[model samples]
Target: MDPGEPDPEPGRIEVLRRRLAQRHGERLFAEGALGPRRDLAGVLAYVLALLVHGVTVALVVAGLLLVVLGWGQGALPVIGGLLLGFAVVLRPRFGRLPDDTPVLRRAEAPQLFALIDEVAAVAGTTGVDAVVVAADANASVTTYGIRQRRMLHIGLGYWEILTPQQRIALLGHELGHFANGDTRRTAVIWNALHSLALWHYFLAPVPEPDLVERITNWVMTPPRWAVYGLLHLLDQLTLRSTQRAEYLADEASARVGSTDAAAELMDRMLVLDSVEVALQRESVIAQTKGGAGTRRETEQGLWERLAARVESVSEREYERLRRVSVLRGHSADATHPPTHLRRRRVSEGEQWQAAVRYDEERAHAIAAELAAARDRVARVVISDTAC
Candidate 1:
């Protein structure tokens, strides 16, 4: 099949299986290379990371040395240098890791854990340490602990909309990140880049709480500029590498599930995301009409009602909405690639028979099993904590 064209043949699954086998035999992903250019980019990303970290070390050492030298000079110099050194030392650099979401324990939902284990085993990784649910319309796998314990986060908003097949595809794609080493490779490098960018915020020459810090801010401005400049350079070089990683993860989804299912999931996610905006608007309107006390009444039959509302949307209307949707084009700095590109990449694989399928029964079973936890989470997510 042509790269741009869809595969309609009954043997599409068999074709994909052969392609995956060929890729394995050739070890195309051994060093994380889907193409020669991507391989070169991967090497460049590591080299860039090392160079950036070296500069950070130099800055820290320089700060410490200044502290020592200033101490030898005089009290005023010592105070200034010591304070500046501390700022450099203590300024946080890494992005805030994903940890605020509510946790879902195995005891509360063994069925969900079972599904996660199945996907993780297929992805060739140790099972996840936790399953979390959040208010978002996205699902992801994150790391925690010194051992980098994997945690799976299922966005209940998104979960309510997906079919069984799409759920598997989503989990498979996330686990694929673990399986393909994307998480480990980018963990330190991306964190370093984020830290570099963040140092600017810490050292920015803004008004400070104390007189000493105000003075320290003036001295630290130069380092702040340097960090930001390096951050820009690194982001430019690594953008393609990040995009490639996402593509590989999508390919992994295709391998674990099916290409058609993955593509459909991507397409549906965009539609559902758009539809959710309308749903929220309606929810607000209902709140205004009925009052805050009536919220429970509104939420009682929410999903079934909303699901029907979504299903009632005409295809032409959906296509029209999607044309102007945020999912239309690639985001410049997003962690994932554009939905269209991702859908296309997965769909481009060869046609085969025996494609995997997920029915409504499993989807309902998983949802029913986790319904109680989902309710608690939904309350926390959708309501005011003050009340």
Candidate 2:
């Protein structure tokens, strides 16, 4: 799988699946004991995903066969016909969801794209196909289209809040997701899991199942149970793997960016969530009270105020942060290693050349350049919230 080569087709999703498995194998060899058990877990997840799909198809086919066979038999024909009709209505549809995130063209933010390119080069990741600016306070790289072209999404909330150093570190971390093969791999697995969920949603017993509906439950409950069992198994295999992937991604960021920068970014993330919550509350209040100014201005004011809140975290807040166990790896329920662990990893690590410039002047310029896109995203946030 050459990084330079284009992905073949929408239908060749299975090839990507194979490539993901091979990538996992290469990772195992490259990482030795330090590698997460995720490759195997990924393999298992992909396999189980396929198995679930196959079993679903097979069961549908079997039900159809039962219907055809039952037609000749006495009472079984009626039962079979009913079951076949039930399956038809309850089948899950496989359609891709549209990308609602606001996309930023190179013309709109040439500087941001250039920055992304610089970060990607240092992080050893492939080129990005698109850049998305959204209203949230985080960043990620994802794949879309038949060719599985990669896109990077920057959350305006976080973008406005993070320092230049933190921004570079965050971008490096997101690009690292592509380098570690987590982006494309996770995309497939997520879709698989989603398909199962859709299946369960459609097939689960209805509110008022008549006798025929009861029969549908009798026939479908086993497969529904199977889906649940497989979902749980997939989670067990992949949860820790997800946590490890996060750690590896951070290390990748540290390699390209500074460890201290990355560590500080993680620490800031602990409080960013709180900041975002406050921003959301303020936005709603402004909207409700019909305060002066356009939604965009209110959004801007709320964002500025929220940034101020982040800048002035009280000693009590610091103490609360210190006491926070969830941010320190206390919960296995989370996908990422806790904030404390990530900060420690980066802070204690050897320093490296900064991948992108992090001076105050450049930071200010970047913020100015992104101001328009940020305002547009603010409108998006307000509109979404109002709905």
Candidate 3:
């Protein structure tokens, strides 16, 4: 669909979805509102963790500076250790899937039924409730309510690859989230708080009692590499959160289809005009060498790696993916796991696929509000066309 076209009612779209979701007498879900609260404890725990991580890291940095500067001898490592501890904890980013739009629609493909049926059996659930394609750039799969609105986002690059079977197989994994609603719902609060933590990310400074102001200032002064290191650490943590989510999705996919399918899909998507993965890496390797011969060699290595990862898919397909950002400039900070990592874990069969129970109180309560975001997704992309 041209992102410019106005969408039909999501509730109406839900009707088309019902046909796709309920093939085979499957217990299809249709809810979109937010679930009830259960992640409170999980969120609280993480908050406590951040507090602890921050305080401890500050102390350790202080201790290290004291010793290195000879302000104190034995206490330096101890203090540094405290600061490092907090740094380690606070530095790692975590969050739940942000509340976003999820569009539910039917498979125009007649063959979609078999794939749905197969996954339904694996998921031990009826219908997937919806087949979601992210209206935007991010790639994610999230389920809300009893049959869940199974939202699966693909980068424009990813949609370019794949036979119909591949798409259905990918969708099957989203169905896994519905079946594994148990696990997903359980993680919701952990996710919500994590999401909140990220949404409100800041270096607002340590509380007075644990201030690392003096040391933090010194370390960050003089164009400190430590500041850069800390930023990298945060990015790494964010990447990990996304990676974990992919692990969960891969595991879900493998349970219904072959690990190879999931792995291939992920690998293909990673390099497909992923400026972060493909262009950015190429640029970095080139700069690292800074000589014509060396630059060529570095780019060649990156090219070969990217080419091998997507050998099954054609360059023309990726070229199509490049179209996604043709009107835009390079983006920074990819929110998904690296394609290579996603491929490896899926191929190996991750632990995240197993069935877990959804917390009804939490999931059900959130369903109504959740649907609002779905409605927005069904509507907003029309305007983004201009953007």
TM-score between model 1 and native = 0.71
Best candidate, TM-score:
2
User: Per-model C-alpha lDDT, please?
Assistant: 0.60, 0.65, 0.42
lDDT of model number 3: 0.42
C-alpha RMSD values across all candidates: 9.9, 10.1, 19.5
Ranking by TM-score: 2, 1, 3
State how far residue 170 of model 3 sits from its true place (Å).
Answer: 1.6
Listed in order, each prediction's TM-score against the native is 0.71, 0.73, 0.37
- The model with the greater TM-score, 1 or 2, is 2
RMSD of 1: 9.9
User: What TM-score does candidate 2 reach?
Assistant: 0.73
Q: Largest lDDT belongs to which candidate? A: 2
Which ranges of candidate 3 are over 4 A from the true structure?
A: 1-102, 105-114, 123-126, 134-139, 144-157, 179-248, 274-338, 345-387
Q: lDDT per residue, candidate 1, 1-387, as tens digits?
A: 112333244342234333333333223323344653345546666787777666666666766766666666757456656556745664434323345556766777777787777766765666677887765566777776656666787776676676677677788788877766552245667666655655666666766448887888778878877776666556555555555566777776766667766776776665554545645654665557666656666556555555666567677765654454333342212444555555655776643221334556666777787777566654543353221
Pairwise TM-score winner, candidates 1 and 3: 1
**Tens digit of lDDT per residue, candidate 2, span 223-299?**
88877666666655555455556666787777766777787677677665566677677667667767456565676
| Model with the higher lDDT, candidate 2 or 3 | 2
